[model samples]
Target: MKEYKPSFLFRNAHVNTCFPTFFRKVEIEYRRQRVLLRKDDFLDFDWVEKGNSKIIVLCHGLEGSSQSHYIKAFSRYFSERSWDVLALNYRSCSKEPNPSPFFYVAGKGDEIATALKLTSEYQEVVLIGFSLGANKVLDYLGKEEKIPKNVKMGVAVSPPCDLKESSLLFSKGWNRIYEQYFLKQLKRKVIEKEKKYPNILKEIGISIEKVQKATSLVEFDHLVTSQLAGCSDAYDYYEKNSSLFHLRKIHHPTLILTALDDPMMSEHCYPREEVKNNVWLHLETPQYGGHISYASFEKEYWLEKFVFETVNQFQNRK
Candidate 1:
């Protein structure tokens, strides 16, 4: 792994965490495309063309879209490097609401497979997923016996490998702040879904009142996410979906990036033992970098530069 030296002025974890959201500026022009899925559902993709055969597919974190700062930053970085970029937005995550009421979850690898099929024309492809999307990528690679020949490698940043553990952490102090933010967005989406598919919430045994009363992510997941996704409950959902157990089965060359100080994940989220045993997996846990944010005053966003360089190294070695 390349050495990471964070700027001294903003080395504090929280400072590095919050700096980019307020200071970083990313503007990338993209041509939007909607991908139709098998179940009559659709995913929105933002394409930044560089007229190159090599392509990179970016999967954003929970509640994130193509306009996310990290997505835009990487899109611009790879586009400048002459690589085609496709930023996948999960169902209902784009400008238009999805027709189906069911949305994406952390371990929904099938959706990633659907996205990969759409990129068959590219000679080379790399999957880069952040947070929740990262878990989806790892799950997909592990479960599939064979991956697309064009997909060379994958990079997952700050993934919640163990969904149950991460959920427990989110219900506690400080972490509750993050939980509340996510819950607000999720609730809004659920309400929107209710408007289009009125029977969805009823079918899942979740009422609009119960959803409005949700105070934590755990409660929300149990009441809505788990039911809508066909799990018995939140625990069952986490048990079936968490990527930690699937890590050992991955055959593709993959890099996992996380930080010891990441507020969103518990220590269990880092699969150090699994990575040590798996030849295909590479793990890097820096001393700092909160969640997906790895900002430095000098570089503004260190994660973007690190990912670009690491991916390039992987490409050259391949």
Candidate 2:
């Protein structure tokens, strides 16, 4: 073999190599706190507050929490800049299950709107989300209801803009890794729900064992996720909730970052000309960054720099 370059070695390293060590460091460093959004038995949001100036709500992806690496890094970055952050954990994600019968989805902007109502009381708000969280943020913005007066802008990273494309992408080659990982977590969560609501599981005629054996995200969604959550089917859920359909309605300054190599999303997910003139939407399509992977040489990766700088620029412009 030719002499291995340092960067090349770093990129492809297995076991305890640069990539593994980086993820470990990221996991350990980003501290998060569990917070309750409601008092009695409603939904709770896990939040971590940093800095001072305005409030920024950070939303985690499917089956993710406030403790995710990206959430921690972004929180630290914004906090240091005098911007406070609240990372909202979707319904059952924080630690325990949510009390309500319903959970959050890409279209259920109510929970987020509720969180924003609480946070926006003190400072101007900026919404940032990754993966599934990003899709919901976009959907929230696309809604006709009046957003809080303080929300200035929004940012979405590796968003599954088009659910139809995303679902198909997850079914292919190396992308199966992401699909499998998500399916595992989702299946586990569903089983956990089964234990809590045995009647609901029986009513849907789905066994937890079948959920565990699911081969694809769509299969799992069709059998368990949609029924447990009260949707007609996976197709109905995808069609009704996908953010891509409502992109034209986005009114705020939004920065959407996606990668061509993102296994979980398709190349067609990047819509260059779909951006309307009214919405200050910036779409950045880099060549690398698998899913939300933003590996780099310096301490700060390109995605981090782009998100921080973009938000700062937008905030300052106001």
Question: What is the Cα-based lDDT of residue 75 in candidate 2?
Answer: 72
Each prediction's whole-model lDDT (CA): 0.85, 0.70
How well does candidate 1 match the true structure in TM-score terms? 0.95
Q: Write the per-residue lDDT of candidate 2 for residues 81-134, one digit (tens) a residue.
A: 777777777777777766444456766456678777668665688889898898
Q: Which lDDT tens digits does candidate 1 get at residues 163-281?
A: 99999999887777778889999999888888877776677578888989999888998988888788998999998899998999988889999988888888889999999999999
Residue 228 lDDT (model 1): 76
Each candidate: how many clashes? 0, 3
Model 1: residues with Cα > 4 Å off, grouped in runs: 38-40, 298-300
Model 1: residue 119 alpha-carbon error in angstroms = 1.1
User: Which 10 consecutive residues of model 1 have the lowest summed lDDT?
Assistant: 293-302
